[model samples]
Target: MHDELPVQESGPTASGSSPASAPGSTPAPRNPGRADQLDRRGGLDRLGWSVLRPAPVVCLTLVAAVIATGFAVRSSTAEMGILIWIDAHHTPALDGVAWALSWAFESPRAIAVVVLLAAGVAWRCRHLIDGLCAGIALALTWGTSYLVKLLVGRHRPAWTLLRHHVGGPEQDPSFPSGHATFTTALVVVVVMCTRRGWRVWIGAVGCVLAAGVAASRLYLGVHYPSDVAAGIVYGAAAGYLMVRATTLVSHARPDRRAGQDEDELRSGPGEIS
Candidate 1:
């Protein structure tokens, strides 16, 4: 009789107790979600794609173009034809235009402009990845230009002028201009690295400057017309490769930890890594 009474009373006793008053009972708090992990992972994936995937394409394309241009240069008839074309096409009006535009590729002047432009890009990108990309572009332009100039051993139009005037040294192996290469590289780098809306306009202007420089090389007559042509191709290829490489290199590095902590923290938990 007592057992039956206690069992019947147990239900009512438990039902009357509030959670806080209950023994061995507590509320469960919510947990952080997979959103954080997903954001981080996505960033890493993009980086990997940029670096690992595009590299082979850039390298192979460059190699092919080099071989092809070299073959084209081997044709004497074609080379003579181009020379005739340049010589006949030259006029006072054209010379004036070329001279005016040539100032952009003037070595020390261009270098200063390039440095300032790079600094501005770095400042604006300010993010760790963006800044690194800009830096790499600048380094590639300066370093690769130097390396190519040494290896190619091409002479400038300025050298030929010296022979005629008895003031300048003999023209070096006049092929593949250093000026065009560096300028083209700068153009490609800036265009690729920028996120600005008017970046295309900026890049187009860079192209014009590079073309003007190349034209100047030919007009001065130290370099064969072919030399400037080759330089344009070489510089353009280098720029394309390096800029792509920068993108790849920048993106490839995974942000496992906080990068630019302020940016990361500001991004918040729901934001991308």
Candidate 2:
């Protein structure tokens, strides 16, 4: 979201002081107090403020919980159980639909497209920070997914042995589904960048899209439920962190109006006129 600063016209004031002082006149001194305050608020404080919001806190907690659960259950038995159940009920129609959905969101291209669209919207709205955050989030999601896959070293579901096998062979590790991660990250960026009035609609659509991508992974017998779940958690966390980073950087900029607003927020109610 963009915040408009009020425009100030240069002219004589009520006291008749010229708007432009003489070239030899001493320049107004910098506000030492403001400088001190800015110095005190280091990068850590900015980051803390960015992530201290309620929504981010909730999302971060969920991410931690999901990661913990994944660690606790090292085996894919739980994943296999769900996959088997889904396999038992699979139909040709479902397979066709899942295949189409899965094919549509394969890897970096679909992820890049979503990020680009979100960035385009943000740029159109004159919210450069939002656009940057979207791009950062997608980049982080992709990189993190690859790193985690390497660390976890989990194999993709062995669909060839199954009677209802429809999915093609996948070479990547399967602890976290990249498609799910990318789609979820995109959804998070879209939800955060959208205006309040249209946020609900955007969020709803994003949720459905994310869910469809996740489900497609399962229906295609390529990813286990746990993989998709972990991916979602990773993606959401990445998006949240990137958004927070953008906010922190924006606030930390040398903007007079922004500083005044921050000071007002910090001041007691009695201090406000």
- What is the C-alpha lDDT profile of model 1 across 69-106, one tens digit per residue? 54455333334444445656677777667665565565
lDDT by candidate, in order shown: 0.52, 0.65
Clashes of 1: 1
lDDT of 2 by residue, 141-239 (tens): 667777877767777877665668776678877877888888888887666555445658977898899999899888777888888988888888876
TM-score of 1: 0.57
Q: Whole-model lDDT, candidate 1? A: 0.52
Highest-scoring model, lDDT: 2
> Which stretches of model 1 miss by more than 4 angstroms?
1-59, 67-93, 127-132, 152-170, 247-273
- The alpha-carbon RMSD values of the candidates against the true structure, listed in the order shown, are 12.9, 10.6
lDDT of 2 at 243: 60
How close to the true structure is residue 260 of candidate 1, measured as C-alpha lDDT? Answer: 33
